[model samples]
Target: MTAQILDGKTLAQRLKGQLQTWLAEVSPQVGRPPGLAVIWVGDNPASAAYVGQKQKSCAQVGITSFGGQFPAHTSQGELAHLIQQFNQDERVDGILVQLPLPADLDSTKLLHTITPDKDVDGLHLVNLGKLLRGEPGLQSCTPAGVMRLLGHYQIPLAGKQAVVVGRSILVGKPLGLLLLASDATVTFAHSRTPDLAGLTRQADILISAVGRQGLITPQMVKPGAVVVDVGINRTPAGLVGDVDFVGVQAVASYLTPVPGGVGAMTVAQLLLNTVQSYGQRHELVMPQFSG
Candidate 1:
C-alpha cells in the first residue's frame, strides 16, 4: 500500500488558528493575554533557535512570550530562584526551561523546582506522577502531539497492537502511557531488545522515537501498518527519522515524514499547553480546539 503522508505543517497551522480564536475570547475575560516564560541556560545554538520558534508561535496566538537567558556556568541555585519567581508571577501562565542544561547544573533538581501548574514542558515529577496515575495534567508536548496526529488521521487505537521503539522519558514512556490510555496494547522496545525488527513487524501501529538513524527499514514494518516517525537526526543527507522513509512508505498504509510530521505538532502543542496553563491558573474556561 502506498502511504498517505501526514502533513504536520498544515495541521499545525490549523491548530494555531484555533488557538488564536480561543485567545481572542479568553484574554479579554482575564484582562490580558496568557503569558509564557521560556528560560535558557548556556549559549546552545539549537536551544536558542527552539526558544525563538516558540516565542514566535506565542505571538501569533496572542500569548505573551517572556525569555530569560543565562550563561552556561549559571548556578543551579540561581536557576531555581528564577523558576520560583516565575511560578509566583501573576502574569506568567506557562514556564519552560530548554533542555540539555549545562553539566554543572543538576537537571533533576531544576525540573522538580518548577511549579506543576507552570510546568508547560510537563517534566516536573508531580506532573509525571500524575500522568503515571492517569490523572488530568499537561502531557509532554511530543507525545501529546503524537496522539493529536493519530486523532487527526482517525486511526483507531482501541485494542490495536502498537510497538514503540525508544525509552526516553521525553517521548517513549509518556507515549506508551497515552497509547495504553487509548486501549491500544503497547510494547515499549529499545536498542537492547533482541530482534528489534521482529517486534516491529508484529505491530499494527509502529512508532519510532529512537534517535539512531535508519532503525526501522521497510522490512521491519508489517503490511498496512501505520507508522509515525518521531526521530529527528541531522545527517549529511539532511534531517531524517528513525524509520527509513522511502522504503517504509512503500510498505506502510500511513506514514509521517521526518521534518513535517511530529516536529511541527510539537511546536503547536507547546502553544496549546500555554493556553491550558492560563485556563487552569485563572479558573477561566478551557479553550476548545477543533484541530
Candidate 2:
C-alpha cells in the first residue's frame, strides 16, 4: 500500500494560526506581544536557516524576535551575559541559544544561565527534570512536534510497540519518554546495536533521529507501521531524512516527508513554547494545543 503522508506542514500551519489568534486577543491587555529571544552564534549556514525560520514563525504568531548574528569569535562570557540580560527582561518570555556553538564556547554552562522560566527551548536541566518526572513543563521542541503530528492524525499510541532510532538528548530520549507516557512500549536503537533491522522491524511506530541519510531502509520497517523521520541532513542531492522515503513510503502505512514534516513542526513548537511561557508568567489564560 502507498503510505498516507503524515502532513506535518499543514498541521504546523494550523497550529500557528491558532497561536496567532490567541496572541491577538491577549497582547493588548498585556501591553506587549509575547517576546522570544533567540541567541545565534557564528555563521553556520544551517543554523542561520533554522534561526530565520524560527524568527519568521515568531512574527507570524506575534512573538517579538530579539537577538541575532553573533560572530564566531564572540566570547562565552559575552554570550552568557546576554542570556542573563534576557532573563531579566520583563518583555521577553522565552530565550533559546542555537546549538553547535563555536569550538571555545561552553553550551551547557551558557544554557544553564537562562532562567528556567524563560528557557523556551526547554533544554534547561529543570525542564528536562520535569519531563523526566512526567510533570507539566516546557518540552523539547522536536520531540514535542513529533507527538503533535501523530496526535493531529489521531494515531493510537497506547499498547503499541515503538522503536526510536537514535539516542540524543535532544530528540530520541525525550521522544521515547513521551511514547512511553502514552503507554507505548519503547525501544531505542542506535549505531551500536548489533541488529538494527531486527529491532526496527518490531515497531508499530518507528522514528529515526540519526543525522545519517538513508539509515532506515524500507526493508528495516514493518509493513503497516507508522514512520516519523526526524533527521535533517544536507547532501549534494539536497536535503534528505534518515529514512529512505521513496522506498519506505511504499512499505509503511504512514510516512512523514523530509522537508515538510518534522522540520516544520519543530519551528511551530518553539513558537508554542514561547507563548506558553508568556501565558504562565503573566498568569493569563492560555489556549492549549495537542502535543
Evaluated at residue 194, the lDDT of candidate 1 is 93
Write down the lDDT of every candidate, Cα atoms only.
Answer: 0.90, 0.92
Among all candidates shown, the one with the greatest TM-score? 2
Clashes per model (N, Cα, C within 3 A): 0, 0
Report how far residue 146 has shifted in candidate 2, in Å.
Answer: 0.4
Compared with the true structure, what per-residue lDDT tens digits does model 2 show for residues 122-215?
A: 8899999999999999999999999999988999999999999999989999999999999999999998998999999999999999999889
List model 1 lDDT by residue over 229-254, tens digit each.
Answer: 99988888778999889999999999
What value does the lDDT take at residue 157 in candidate 1? 98
| Candidate 2, RMSD to the unseen true structure | 1.0
